[model samples]
Target chain A: MPLTKRIIPCLDVKDGKVVKGTAFVNLRDMGDPVALAARYAAQGADELLFLDITATIQERKIFLSLIKSVARQVNIPFTVGGGISSEADAYNLLSAGADKISVNSAAVKEPALVSKLAKRFGSQCVVLAADAGMQADGNWQVYVNGGRKNTGISVLCWIEQAVQMGAGEILLTSINNDGGRKGFALSLLQEVTARVQVPVIASGGAGSLQHFADVFEQTGADAALAAGIFHEESITIPQVKQYLYKQKIPVRL
Target chain B: MKLVIVDYSAGNTCSVIFALNRLGIAPVISADAAEIRAADKVILPGVGAAGSAMLSLQQNGLDNVLRSLQQPMLGICLGMQLLCTASDEDDASCLDILGGQVQKLDAPKIPHIGWNDVYDLRGDLFKGLPENSYLYFVHSYGVPVSRATIATAAYGQSFSAAVQKDNFYGVQFHPEKSGDNGLLILKNFLNL
Candidate 1:
């Protein structure tokens, strides 16, 4: 059967500009997110993910308007997450042109909320975002509230519950390698992808095109999501796909 | 009067946009309820999980909006998956606009990623293309060959490479990356 491999560009939005950094802090401005999105869309990116890295519990509605504006400019599908709490909040993001609403901290707070949104909007809309920080014990621990607090649940187990509760996809981020250019934690990806039936987007630790190829080949992930490489223009989506193509890994060129 | 790229977050739409622009067409990217309905022709592009893409559509209240459109709508990749009744990705329940299910390839190489050919063509998207026209493809899941199928492709198994239903059409391959064949497909779709 024919299935298209996805090439996704991630934008870390802070006050409407795409930003990037290492280990989730000390961010620097990249460019206008809307323009970058348009540029990526023009370059053949499979999709775009907008992470409201600054969408603290305080400033939210502002993010929605940004999402709305960004949605208006581009013709491809985009996902918005960060500071999303209630069903209405998710609905608003969707209303603003967000094709998907990802739940991380909120889902951890009220585990049932995943099912609620999935039931109300269908499972496909709800994404379970698991921010994994490696513990001394070698377990990928789940973090919530913008990676400020650690949820005691195992990241793998939390993802499993989220799927059972009705999440359509899992966006897994590795704190150890996020923006480090050390490449993805294929081991962790192997663990997560083996268990979940849903599409798993491998985030964090992407420094090169081969990193993406390795993620799909080694971990069996459906898509590879990265921020810095794309934000810095280190590697373009077409470049990544073309690299994958040369490797005999099927991509849309 | 112009090519309209449907902005549902079903997958990567940029490739199509880039492809069209390379072919000298300035396509409009839209997700607004009104704009997409107003476009001369529409292309739905997608990647990622099928169920999530469907949710994105419904969350934006776009499913109904897309279903009611009179303009030609072309679904690409997972965008194609969303047109069906269901898909196995994330155990999704799709738009049911086209009666089919997007099933996982599940072969030894799980996500079948590579170049493949649309063995035979019978749709407007490939009007000037020849039989077994090769196009770029990279996916792990696919829509089963059904009544909607208009073209066939081979990877590990034979499946619906392209489909047409009413004004809605779908392609399993990425014509944008397939050189001249892809450009011709874009021209054909815009004219249809």
Candidate 2:
């Protein structure tokens, strides 16, 4: 049997509460992380991705608590990312209840961190979250520090290198399509999925249910992730799964 | 009934413990031989490489305890692979309670990190779950089907999704990480 395409709900967490923004700006509070996670899990979300938007040493302590509390409330696989620089951070989060640790800027700064976490905890636990945006040259560039800086690294090259260094899953978020709600960058997703064999999670646009179907049909991504739509309750997770099932996508309802 | 989750530093015991707690089954996470041996039901939960996990079990001397376990014991994920005779993961020799070799999956994906349906189930571990019910899986290596095979899944080839021999039961997927169907599987195991 074919592996079912996954529908994941991403929570952009800041100050221990779920938040969402457009074009990665003007953050708005959504709700408590623990409650939202429980609801999503019960709603049949295949997985949940928590990206800690807090960017401080002191606030990260609060974020850890949120991770622990949310993990306790849900049974599905969840990933924790944001500002994780070393193995200690990864270790703390995994022990706190995160099934996977996603690294973005830290991995871009030092690729060895990916290999270190993958080796110590196993590759299945290490996820490479790449934020890619369209460039004038018709190739995507990798963004670091939560889409604040461009590393000038080609997105395709970085994905290949990350996978080789032992990143088991790749959370590919298109910067240009992020919060745009128009659609996912299917071409970029298709390119990355073609380049790497690991499961790729396409994040960014996801305006309607059809977008999810488009990503799955057009690309080889194993999953699709969205934040604003899920947080705003514009469409419920079960609705998405029902739609996928009708489209013959083999979703777990 | 007392339940003990074998904790050999393989990682991700919190979710398993939490899931059992939600089911009203408070599990003790330990490497102590007496606790594991005395428990009514034991869960061997693991995540990571087989060689290192086996070494950790040996360091704690839980390897012998597991092999000799008479109570119904269930292994999840890497723990399931470790129940086999050996694995290509670091050329690791395992408990050998289930006579099969764990080999790397020959699939388009290496880790198989998503939900997949398990069909052809034939045991009490999956008592209430319907056929073709999806269970979350994340692993690079798996034990092939054998006399102990109870259920099988296909990624590129058919491998044991669930295995059984005497009172020993092992599932290649993570029931704790999986959703309600997974919780049902855990509930069935607890009842068994």
Candidate 3:
């Protein structure tokens, strides 16, 4: 009867196809993005995220077409991330039927872009995809350019700033936990969720069903996103929801 | 049946168009008053802030067209909020089709995004859908439960998930993106 915790299945897309890799490297073809999205929606995925792993200017047209195709088929709300820098880019994607447009590297390069997008499209349309890796000093540093370049900015500080700039949702992905499937960065998520008033979606390091429950039960994360495990058929969305439901975590079944 | 999705440039009209396409109905997306009035049913789909959306509707004279419609009209998300008497989002006065005020949700999360169950179903909109069926929602402001409320959902408090008064109907959720259950609701609206 309450708002349920979301179980999101992510599709790392490249060349209009779904790809999976570890730590954002060693890419391998999984399947067509549209087919995979439809399958996950049927399996009761709370939401779907499609990140263009190789997002380029040339690939922009391809990504838009892909979004249109997916929108035509899949019925669930979805967000698309990667290479979205300007307001026009975000508008194009939203017009093409993306429920939300996520920004990571772009927001870091120009912090005001978050506010601009949010103002023009409303906060709910802008999702700040904050990717970070833990440092030796135990602080997390924000990473950009698909987790290649480090901004040297504290992840905690950056997320707070973005939220103030009108980011409606936070998609916090731990670069170290990504692709490793160890588990979510629970502490980071807990800290970020506690700091921001918007919904926080925890990404990276979702290996097992318990990881899904742990993130929800331990932290105030609104959603948990996993890519590889679902792509490999090792874990299904329904299985994860069923597990979370049993754990007393409210999930839509 | 002729159906038109009111295109006020404030909502996800494409998704609503595709949802109807799946149901074998190709709805005409229009901002023209005549086209909308000509249709058997009209869907007012909206997202984003209430003030600007109201401005767009008033600028294009859709505010009056929507208010005068004798046929069934279904408003989605912010479209639904615009049907209320007023909204707390921008202190904006709405179309006043429905007798209530849209206030910001008193939840821990501001926007209240993602799926939630809609219980206390009534009217023909939720026909065939099970009680407490999960529907996708992404909004911050909602109309508190009132006499016209046909269905209810809770985030931090109980709010109107679906509301109807004669020919005017509104849903605070995006049924177009709510998968099967949402499509079913759209179908029900079409049948009405």
Candidate 4:
């Protein structure tokens, strides 16, 4: 049987509570991390992505504790990202209860960091998250540091490199479309999925269930991720899944 | 039932533990042969390369102990691959409790990661699970359908999704993370 497309709910945590931001800019508080996580899992979310917006040393400790508590409450695989620049950082998060460690800016700085984490803990444990924005030339450029720094690296080149370095999954978030509530960058998602063998999770503009269906149908992404809509309860995971199933998309009902 | 999850340095046993905990069964995660042999049921859970998994099992002397287990045992993902005769991943020889060998998937994707439907169910391990029900899978290698095969799934090709011979059972998917379908399968195994 073919693998079903996945619907992932992203939680951006600042301090200790989950937050939501627009295009990686203004942040707004959502709710408690553990409570929100339990809700999503019970709602039948395929997977969860936790991005530590503020990875301060103090916040890091709180985040790990949050992970420990959430792990007990949620019974699905979850990926954690933000400030995972070293193997030790990855180890700490994994031991704390993250199934996968997503590397972004740090990985672009040291491409070997991907291989290092993959070697220590199987490739399946490493997730390559790339923040990209479409350029005037119609090419997506990689961004770093929460979309504040443009690395000038081609998105395709970076994805190919990370996959070669042993990243098992790719989390492609379109900076332009992120928080716009328009729709996903279908062209960019298609480009990444075509270039990499690893599963590509499309993140960014997800205004409605139709937007998700469009991304899944137009692109080869294995999953679609959203934060604002899910956090605000504007759209529930079960609603999105039911929509996908009705659209003839294979979703776990 | 007394449940023991065989732990041979395999990664991500927490999900399995949590799944069981939800059902009110506090299972022990141990590599101890004595505890495993004495358990009413055993779950051989693993993740990572087959070579390293085999080496770790042999190093801990759990390889032979796993083979001698008389109770109903379930192997998951890498655990399932390890129960076969051998695997193409690093050309590692595994515990031959079940007939057939594990080979790398010829799919366009190397690691078949995500949820997929498994059909042709034929064992108590899949009791109450509808045919073509979805389950989570994450692996690069898998065993081909053989005489012991009770279920099969199609990726780039047909492969053994679940297998059983005597009291030995193996599933290529992660029932722990497969949501309700997974919970039901684990419940079936526990009932067995």
Candidate 5:
């Protein structure tokens, strides 16, 4: 038997709070990021990714204090994102004890930067995050700034480009499916996974553990990342994994 | 003696320590050379890309400290990958602490999420774990299944799920987040 990838639950933080809504709005504070992260860790969340959604635009710190506290408390791999425009931002997150730094808007704006960091720090240290929204033409277009800015780049094409530029992994989130919890956009996932060689983490539209199994079994993505459900305890990571085990989809127990 | 978790900027040390306490085994989080040297055992937990993590280890001079430890050591997730000779994630030149290369999990569907089963359990870690018991995993790349693989799991392909070589043991999955079976596997590691 070989090694399997991961299933992660994400938390989008803005102004020192965890918030999630459709198309990235309706910001309601859920709980402290550290407490929420620890709760998820206890419930079997494989890893945690905390994104400081507003840090980049304001040039403020990307929730370093929250990350530090979470690192102090949790025992799982943690990736920090949002407003991560510079290598310094990446370094700070690492210093705060983040395992990985996720870049989305910045990567699309400056493709060379991803490689530069990957060259300096290593590709595994840089994760390219793409907020994808299906365009009217049926291509997945990349969006940024919480799905507000359209980069006019095809997501699959961008993924290939990022990988070529030395991005170790791609955190592909579908604005079309995000917060819908209606299951992922299978067509979108299938397309991206087919073209990208690096790990593709499927984000958005996860309502049930079966939704996770459906995406992993069908799309062959390296991992499935969800937020609303995991945060609200609609489904626990353990329950999802147990169901996947029953489905015979390989998970690490 | 309390379980000692090595802290070298890798994020998961505290979580692993908490997991130990939950299993009724309190662990001490330490990056100090002397504390690690004096501990009964050490578990190195990490996440993120390999190269920088290696740099953090080297910056703290833990690279040497970890390699020299005679006590039982279990590296988790990226911790396990760091022990390997190399990894595809960052073209990472790893600890070379263990043989083999960490390869990319190139597949149709990725981030292989959810609870899947691990098979070919080799040691006490799987004692109470059901045949194919589920463990939590969240990684982009993995060390190629090698002689050290104690168990295996399948996604787009089967790969190393757990590894054991001498005093060094590692699991790609998060036993801390893996519920009872994960706790049991962790308990087994503690007993080791």
Candidate 6:
């Protein structure tokens, strides 16, 4: 079989606990990050991503501890993101046991950090997490700081530049579709996946198994990421993979 | 078993150590030639460009030490590529324990990340695992299927997912991060 499409369950973490919010607000405590990670691994999650929603310099130690604990138990690969502004932060997380470290607002502020991280670590270790929302002109604009500030930069152009700077993978979350559970932003994902050669992970707006299938079929996204759906137990990773398998979408089972 | 994960600072050693710890084996992470040579089983875990990884291995004199080891040595990902004669990633010469050249993957996507099935299993490394068992992979370069290849996986084309020659074995997939089946592969290697 070819490379199977990944089904990643994201854990939006705050302080040291796992939390989920709608469109990145009104957060609800899910559970312990380590416990949730073990559950996902047992359920055959392809990978896990922990987004430190409220990452502060003071909380770095807490987040690093969480990563170390998760790495000790969870056998699958996991990535830690949010507020990683420097090479030291990225290195600390990787050393703490994260398979990859994602950069977002930090990379937008310092594009050279992407290249530096990629050169120091391999491209495979750097993931560019882009949060984009549609603009009035019908173009997607890049948003940072948890989608509060719009950079007025075209999503396509920013993604292209980041990839050139050596980002190995693209984790694209449609700010409008996120936490809505309507469905993935197919058009945005389609455009980005088509433009990039690296694997594109579609995030946000995953309501059902059909939503997962649609994103994989309609767009060139290599993976689909959802937090609320899995956290709520509305649909499980195994269920999604089985559904995709029936749809003839290659998924690891 | 006294397992030692050869750490040349190539990355991902912590994951490997944690994986082994889950299996009840506390592997010693070391670059010292003596410690690695003394271990019953040695694992060479790597995650980075071949050129720099090779450079680190040589700088620590691990290249010669690894080439001379007689224990069951297993290489994962970039570590696997380094077991080959050479790699096209940085045009670096490898340990040549295995008979092949690591070349860039000829696929639409450069780094083929995610789970893929490994079939055509041939050695004790896959002892209890079924054919077409899924394993996680993340790399831009891979060693094409050759005489030493014990199992094969396809991205754009079939490449060596696992290879074995005498006491040395190499797998392009990251068993440390490949979930249960991956841990089984590591357990199998440990048993060997």
| lDDT tens readout by residue for model 3, B1-192 | 899988888856899999999999989889999998899999998888999999999999999999999999999999899999999989999999987899999988888898899999998999999999989998889999999999999998999999999999999999998988999999999899
Single-chain TM-score of chain A, each candidate = 0.96, 0.98, 0.98, 0.99, 0.95, 0.99
**Per-prediction TM-score to the true structure, in the order listed:** 0.69, 0.98, 0.98, 0.96, 0.73, 0.99
- lDDT, candidate 5, residue A67? 80
DockQ of 5: 0.20
> What CAPRI class is candidate 5?
incorrect
TM-score of 2: 0.98
Ranking by DockQ: 6, 3, 2, 4, 5, 1
Query: Per-residue lDDT of B122-153 in model 5, one digit per residue for the tens?
Result: 88767767666766676768777888999888
Query: How close to the true structure is residue B138 of candidate 4, measured as C-alpha lDDT?
Result: 81
Task: Using DockQ, give the best candidate's number.
Answer: 6
**What lDDT tens digits, residue by residue, belong to model 6 across residues A100-167?**
99999999999999999999989998999999999987899999999999999999999999999999
Off by over 4 Å in 4: none
lDDT of 5 by residue, A150-178 (tens): 88888888889888888878888899898
Docking class of 1: incorrect
- For candidate 1, the TM-score is 0.69
CA RMSD (A), model 1: 7.0
- Listed in order, the DockQ scores are 0.11, 0.81, 0.83, 0.63, 0.20, 0.86
Off by over 4 Å in 3: none
Whole-model lDDT values for every prediction: 0.78, 0.91, 0.92, 0.89, 0.78, 0.92
Model 3 clash pairs are: none
Best model per lDDT: 6
- Per-residue alpha-carbon lDDT of model 2 for A1-253, expressed as tens digits? 6788889999998888888999889999999889999999989999999998877988899998888887778999999999999998999999999999999999999999989999999999899999998999889999987898999999999999999999999999999999999999999999999999899999999999899889988999999999899888898899999998899987888
